[model samples]
Target chain A: MSGKSRRDFLKSTALIGAGVTGLTTTAKAGPQNILSEDRMGVLVDTTVCVGCRNCEWACKDAHNLPAGNLEDYEDRKVLDTKRRPGTDALTVVNEYSHGKNSSLPIDVKVQCMHCDHPACVSACIVGAFTKHENGTVTWDTDMCIGCRYCMAACPFQVPAFEYDKALNPMIMKCDFCFDRTKEGKLPACVEICPVEALTYGKRSDLIKIARDRIKRNPDKYVDHILGETEVGGTSWMYLASKDFAELEFPKLGKNPAPGVSESIQHGIFAYFVPPISLYALLGGIMWITKRRKELDEEVK
Target chain B: MKKFLALILVLVFTIGINAQQSPGKDHSKLNLSCKTCHSCDVPTKSDPCLVICPREKITTVYQKPEQTPELITINQLSDRYGPVYFSHKIHAQMSIMSGGCENCHHHNTSGPILKCNSCHETSRKREDVSIPDLKGAYHRQCMDCHREWSHETGCNSCHTLKKDLKDTKNESLQKKYSGKDHPVIIEPTKLVYETKSDKGKLVTFYHDDHTKKFGLNCTSCHKQESCTKCHDVNNTDKSKNQKVVTKKTFEDQHSNCISCHSKTENCSKCHGEKTLEPFDHGKKTGWALNKHHINLSCAKCHGSKLPYNKLDNKCLSCHKGWNAENFKHSITGLQLDEMHSELSCEDCHTDGNFGIKPSCDGCHDDYSFPKQKPGKLVK
Candidate 1:
C-alpha cells in the first residue's frame, strides 16, 4: 500500500478513538454509577441459618414468579443436591455439614453479591446494567439485547439466561429486591428469614455488625467475612463457621473484577494519545523503508 | 428565703447521690468478680462501662422446674402462625442435664429473669445487628435441639398456621398443658457396656448406685448431653436400634468417669469379665456396713470426694464425739441395768473396742456374755 493512503487510514482511526473516549467520559458521570456511603447491604450469618428454604419461596413470590405452596419448599431433599441461581429461581440456599457440629448444618443462601463495582455494568455492550447508589446492581430488561457477556463477566457466575425461550430471552439474577427497597421495604429474603440470619442495613453499618459478631463469637465463626474485600467489596457479605472455600464460594482476589479490562480499554483510547502515537510511528517507519528501497534501485 | 432555697438544693443533691450509688439490680449477692460484667475498674452510674452482652460470664437465676410455669403461650410477633404452645416446665426439666437455664436464658444477670424481649428486639429491622431479634432468638433456641432430635425443620413442627387454627382462643390447648408435667424419668439400675478393651470386655455402670449410694448429682456426668441422646425420634425401636458409635478421643470417651476415677487407675477397675455388683462396702473394703451405716449414703462416711478414702476399723475413728457420758447403750439394743450403767465403759468394754464382743471376765467371774447378760435387750 502507498504511504499516503496508510497515513489517511491512520488519521481516521485516531479520530474514531478520540470520539469514543469522549463519549465514555460523559457516561461515567451518570447518576446510576454513583457509589453512596449509605448504600444498603445484607450480612448473612450462615451459622444461624437452619436450611429452611423459605427465602427461596419469598424471593419468587415477591418477584411475581410462580411460587408454589410454601409447604413444598419444606422438602429438604432438594438440599442434598447442590444448586445455583437459575432463570426460574433467583436465589437458592445450600446446606453444608458443619465443621464443628454435624447436627447443625451451615445453610448458605446463594445469590448475586451485588458488588460495589459490578462487572456486568462494565461488560454490557448496551449499558443495560446499572450499579445504583443504593448498592443494587439492576438490569434494564428493555435495553438488554440477550447478550450472554454478563453471565460470563459475573465474578459469582450469577446472571442466568433464559436459553429455553426462543423469543426475547432475558438475563435473570438477584436484583437486591430493588422495587421493594424503593418503597422502603427489606429485601424479600432478609424479611422472610425465620432466624433473621440475613441482616440488612447500610453497607458501612453491616460491615461493623459483621465485625462485632466475629469478635463476640470467635469460636462460632471464622475470622474472615467473605465478600468484605472480595471483588472490591460486595453489598452482601457472609459469616461462616469454617473456611468459605468448603461452602463452594469462588475464591477471588480483592481487586474489582472489571478493573483490569476497564483500565486497558480506557488507557488505549484516553485522549486518543496511544492510538495517534502508534500510527505516527508506523507512518515514519514506512516512509523511511520506501525511500531506502527507491535509493537502492537508483544505484542499480 | 435564701436559706430555705439552700436547704431544698441540699435535699435534691443527696437524693441524686443515693440513686446513683444504688443500681436497681443488686450485684452484692452474686458470686461474680466485677470484671465479669464491667470492663473498667470503677464503673460510674452515668457510664457503667459494662461489657456488651457478656453472655457466657453472667449467672442465670435457676428455678426448680416445678416452680416454673407449666405452659407458656408465645404470641409476640405471631403473624403467619398462631401462638406457639411451649411446654416451659418440661423444657426446664430437660435442661437440667444439659446447660440448665443458661442454655436459653443466656445473658441473664443476678436479678429477676429478664424476658426474651428485654435484650432481643421485637423488630427484625433494628439499629444493632449484633444480637438477633426476638423471633430469631426464640427460633434459634428451639431449633438448635429440636432439629437435632426430630430432624424436622418444618414450620408445623413448632407452629400451627393461623388459618389452620380452629379455635383462635386456644382454650383447649391451654388445658392440655396447664397441669401437665414431664413424666418421672425412670433411671436404669445398671448398664453393662461391651467395650473393646483386651483386659476385660464388659464394663458395668451402676446408675442407681452412683445416684443414690455414691451421692453423685445427675449433672455430674450428664453435663452436656445432647437432646438426641435420649429423644431419638428416628429410632422407633430402641431395643433393636444400635447406637452409632462415634469415634471419640480417648479423653472424651472417659470424661464422665475420669472426673471421679483417677486416670492412673488400672483398666480392670471398671472393665471386667462380668457385670460387677453394685458397690458393696463389705465385699470391696472388708468392713461390713452395720444397721446404722447401711441406711447412710456412702458420702456420709467417705466424705463427698470420689475415690473415697479408706477408714481404719476403729469405733473412735468415726465416733470421735461419742464418750461414756454422751454414749447411749440403749440405742445399741441393750439397756444397761443400774449396776452395770454405773461402771465405766472401759471396765467391761476394754479399750473401747466396739467391733469385738464385750466380755464380763473384766468385771466379774462366771458372768459370761450371752449366757448372763449385764444389760437387758431393749427389744
Candidate 2:
C-alpha cells in the first residue's frame, strides 16, 4: 500500500476500533449518577474520640506517608494539650476544657467534613476539587495551583495548605478517600478508628443513625444533627456532649457553600457547553483550512 | 563525504521501514539510523514513542508524541487515572499456565503474545466519556482479563486489587495441608546490622501499644504529627536540658502531668500518675511548694512529682522561719513545750493564722475562762 493509504487505513481502523469499543461499553442504567446523589460524609463523635491518634496513624499509613513523631503513645504526652488540624494533620483532636463541672474536657476531632455544597469545589479554579455523590469533597493536588481560597471559603476551616512545599505546593485536607470510595471501602479515618468516633456510612443513613443515638440517650447528646444543617451540610457530621458551639464549631450560614461561585463558574464557563462549543469550533476551523488548501491546490 | 552520505541514505531508508512497522517488534532484527532524524533533514519523527517508563517516573505520556492527548489537558483526568499496579511477572506466568498462550494471543498466528498495550490503545474509546482516551485503553485490558479470571478461577484471579488478597485465602490452603509442618519466616526487609544489643533491662517501649490502645490522642507529650512536644526545641526550655517546663523536681512532672493528662478521655491512666523511680523515706525532700497546698486540692500536692517518698511530717517541713520550738500558744497563755507537745495543737489552735483563742474554758466554761468567784462578785 502507498504510505498515505497505509496511514489512512490505520486511522480508519483506529476510528472503527473506537466505535466498536464504544458500542460494547456495559451501559449502566439508572440516573448514571451512581457517584453523584450518593452524598458520602463522616460522622465524628468527639465524645467517643479517645484521642489515641490512631486515626492520624492510620491516615498516614493509608497514604504511605511518614510516621509522625507520636508513633508510640508511651511517653507520648502531647495529647494532654489541644491542637489544630495542620498540614500533616488532616484531622486533629483538640481538648476543650469547660472546667471540671462540664463532664471532663472532650477531644474534638477536626478534619474536612466533605460538605454537600463544598466551598473547596467552588474555590478551585482548575477544577481540582469535586464533591463525589457520597459527599466527599476531594482534591487533585496534581491539578492544584496551591491557591488557599478553599481554606478561606470553608466555614469549618477544613482545607489546609502545605507551606513547606515551595515548588509544588498543595492544599491538604481529608478526601474521605474518593479512590477508596470508588472501590467500595470506608474512609481511612473511619476504618482505623478502634473506638467508633469516626463512622462512615451513607449520608442519609448516618443522619438517621445520629438521630437514633441522640434519641436513645437523650441526655448524652444534643438534639440537633451537626452536619444535617451546618454550612449547607457536610458529609462528616458530629455528635457532641454539649452544644456544638461549646465544642468550638462555627455557626455557619444557611446557604450551601458552592451556590454563588458555582453559578458564576457555570455562567462564565458554562459547564459542558464551552468545551462542546470549542470542539465544534475546532472542527469547523479544520474543515475551513482543508477547504482552503484544496482551493489553492486547484488553482495551482 | 559522498560514501558517508550514501550510507546515511541507506540507514534512513532502513529506519523509515522499521518505523512503519507496529510497536512490540523483535528489537534484534531492527537496524536504524539516529542521524536521519537528528541531522534535521527529516521534519520530525512521526512515529510515537512507547510509554514503557514507570508511571512514578513519568507523570504522563503522549498517545502520539506529536498530538498531545486532549484528556491529559484536563489535569484532574491524570489524577483520576493513577498508575495501575500491573505485575508483569505474574501476568506472564498466568498466561503460560493457561494452555501455552493461544488464549490471549493476538496478531493472527501468535503462539505466545505479551505486552498488553499492543492491542489496547487510545483507539478503543468507550461511551462513558469519563473512560475516554488512555484510561479506556487501560480499563478494557485490565478489567476484561480480571473478569475472565474471576469466572475461570476465583475472585482474586485478576481482581487481586488488595495486596493481602492472596495471603488471606492461603490460610485455608494451609489447613488443607495439615500435619506437614513448613515453618516459613516471611521477612519483609532484612536489617544489615544490629544497632542495639537485646541485653540489659530493655524497656519494651510499645510505640504501637500506647497508640493502638489509647489511640493517637492518648499521647499527651507529642504534637499532632507526633513529634515530642517537650523536646521540639520550640517547646522546651533549651537552657534546662530540654526538660519539660512543667517538670521541676520530678514531683512537678508528676503533678502538672495529671492536670495535662486530665484533658483526654482516658484520664485515670496518667492522672493517678505513678513513677517507677525508687524512693527513700529518710532524705525528706520537704513538701515542694509553698503555702499553696493549704487551700489547694490534694491532687495538686500528691499529684505532682516530688522527690520519691520524701516526707515533712513536722510543722517545719512546710512552715520555715516559724519558730516551732519557741512559738508559744498565746491563745491559752500556754508555752509551746508545756501544754502543746502531747495535746494535739488543732484541738485548741484551730486556724493556721494563730488568731483564734484556743482555751479549754472557752468551750467547757461557756461563761468565762477566768472564773470570777461568785462570792466576790456578789459583794
Candidate 3:
C-alpha cells in the first residue's frame, strides 16, 4: 500500500474506533435491539422463597462442579453471612433480616442480572460478550483478552475472573443456562425451585405477572417490581415484601446504559465529517506554511 | 363438498343416537343449557373441553374431622429432609374451629378431599403457571397461620433432617402428634373489650349466649380467623397494637352485631361502664327453661331470628306432639279413667291451654283440675 493511502486508512480506522466506543453507552432509557420481543426471563418473588438452597445444589450439578453432599445444602448455617456469586458457586442465596424485630429474614439469590443492554457487552473491547435472543448475556472465551473490563462495568458486580489460574483463565458468571434452554430444558435453578419462588416466562409476560401480583396483594408486597425498568430492563426481575432498597439492591434509573455514549459516538463519526474536517484544516495550514517557505527562498 | 355432507350426516346421526341411548337423567327437567358444563359448541370425546369446576367459591367436601386421614408423609421432592410426619387430624380439627373442611379442601367438588399435589405441580417448571407447586401450596397454607402465630420460618418446625429421622426427638414428636385429636378450645362464655372510643369505653360480649341461645355456629363470626387471633404467643401489647395496622372505625368493630342488633339506637345496651352478665332466659323472658327446655336451643322452637313478640307463650305452640293420644297422661301424676282417657286433651282443659285451670264441665260435669279428680291419681 502507498504511504499516503495507508495514512488515510489508519486515520479513518481510528475515527471509526472512537465512534464505536462513543456509541456504546448512554444514560437515556428506551427500547433497544439487544432484547428480543419474546425474550425469556425469571420473575423472582422473594417473599415465597424459603431459603432452602436446593437451587445452589442444582446449579453446581448442572455446571459439572462438585456440589458436595446434597443433604449438606440444607444446613442453612452458611447463610449466617451474605455472599455473592463466585467461580466456585454460580449462584448464592443470601439471608437478609429486614430489621432487628423481624423474625423471618428475606432470602435473595445472587446471580447475573443479564441486562437488556448489558454493560459487560458494552465494555468488552474485543466484542466477546453477546446478548442472546433468550435474554442470556454470554461471552466467548477465545475472543476475550483477559481485560476484565466487563467486571468493572457490571453494575451488579457479577462477573468473577479466575485470577488464581496461571494457565488459560475464564470469566465466571451465571449464563442463565443458555445451552440447557436451547436444548429444550429449563434453567437449572428454575427447574429445581420447589416453592416456585422463581417464575420463568417471557420477559414481557413476567412484568405483567409481577404487576398483577402486586395489584392483587397490596398488603403482601411492596409496589415496586425490580428490573422492570431499572437500567432499561433486565431478564431477571424481583418482587419483595419489603422495600428493595432495604434489601440492599442498588437503586437505578430507567435509562438504557448505552444511550448517552452512543449519541456522542454517532455525532463524532457522522458521514466521516470529523476526520475530513481535521484533514482539511491540516491541509490548509500546510499549504500556507509551504507557500511562506517558498517566498522566503525566492527572497533569498 | 361430498365429504363435508357425509361428515354432517354422521354428526346428526351420532347426535340422534346419543339422545336415544342416554338413560333417564332428565336433562330437560334440570333446565341446564349445554354450555353449563361443556366449554365447547360441539363437545367431542377427543377434546370435550369440560369446564373447570369454579374454585373461587369454596366447595365443601362432606368430611368430618374424625373421618379424615390422621397422618400424611410428605416426602415428595425432598432428599435432605426426612418425610414430614404431618399431624393431619389435629390440623383438621383446628381447621374446623377456624374454617371448615373447605379451609384446606376449598376446591373439593366431591369425592375424597384432594391433596395439594392433586392440582398443584410438584415442580415449578411446568406449563401451567396458575396454581402454585406442591411445596408452594404447603408453605402458603402453613405460613398463613404460622406467620401470624409462631412467626417462624425454621424448616425444622415441620421438617426433620433425614440423617436424624430416627432420632428420639423427632420420632417422639411425630408419634405424639399423629393419629391424635387436637386439644379442644374451651369457648369463652363472655368477653369484654376495652374500647378506646369516647362513645363506648367498654363492650361486653356474651359468647355462649350467641352459641347456645342464638344458635349461631362457630364459623358465623369467626370466618377467616387464623389460630393467631388468640394463640399468638409472640403478640405482646406493643406488637398486638402494631399488628392491627388496618385502622378500623368504631362502627366497623360493631359491624357484626349491627346485622341483627340496632347499631345507632341505645348505645348503652352493649357499651357499659363495666362488663355485664350473660342474658338469663328466666330473667329476660319472664319464663325460665325448665327440665325439658333447659337443654334445647332457642331456635328449636323459634326457628327464626324474630322478636320475642312474634312468639306467643302457648303450650301447644311448641308442644305440637302433645295430642290426647300421644300425651303421656300418666306423667301428669294421674291415670285417668277409661272414659276420661278416651276424651281429647281439650275436653277437660277447657281452652286447650294447659297453663290455664281446667274445667270439668266438658265431661259429666266432671272433676275440675284442682277441686275434683278424674280417676285414682297415679304418681
Which has the greatest lDDT? Answer: 1
Docking class of 1: acceptable
lDDT of 2 by residue, A1-300 (tens): 565787799899999999877776644233234245556556677655545566776776677677564336322256566667777767776767634322235667777777777777777778788666666677887898877888888878877788887778778887777777789776677665544566665667677778888888897788878888876777778888788888778887678877877677787677688888989999999999999999999999
Model 3 CAPRI rating: incorrect
TM-score of A-chain in each prediction?
0.86, 0.71, 0.78
Predicted model with the maximum TM-score: 1
List each candidate's DockQ score.
Answer: 0.43, 0.01, 0.21
Clashing pairs in 3: A23-A262, A25-A258, A25-A261, A26-A258, A26-A259, A26-A260, A29-A256
Each model's TM-score?
0.78, 0.36, 0.63
Model 1 agreement with the true structure over B1-379: per-residue lDDT tens digits: 9999999999999999978755457764666557656799998778888777645653346678878877788999899998898888889999999988888888775645778997799987778777788998899999888888887788988898998887845677678777787778889788777767778877888889988877788899988889987886775664431332546777988988998898999998888898777888899888888788887887787887877798887778888888778888898888999888888888877778776778898767787777888779985
- Report how far residue B339 has shifted in candidate 2, in Å: 58
Candidate 1 residue spans exceeding 4 A from truth:
A1-27, A31-34, A263-300, B1-60, B191-204, B236-258, B262-268, B271-278, B305-307, B321-379
- Tens-digit lDDT string for candidate 1 (A51-87): 8899999999999999999989889899999999999
Which CAPRI quality tier does the interface of model 2 achieve?
incorrect
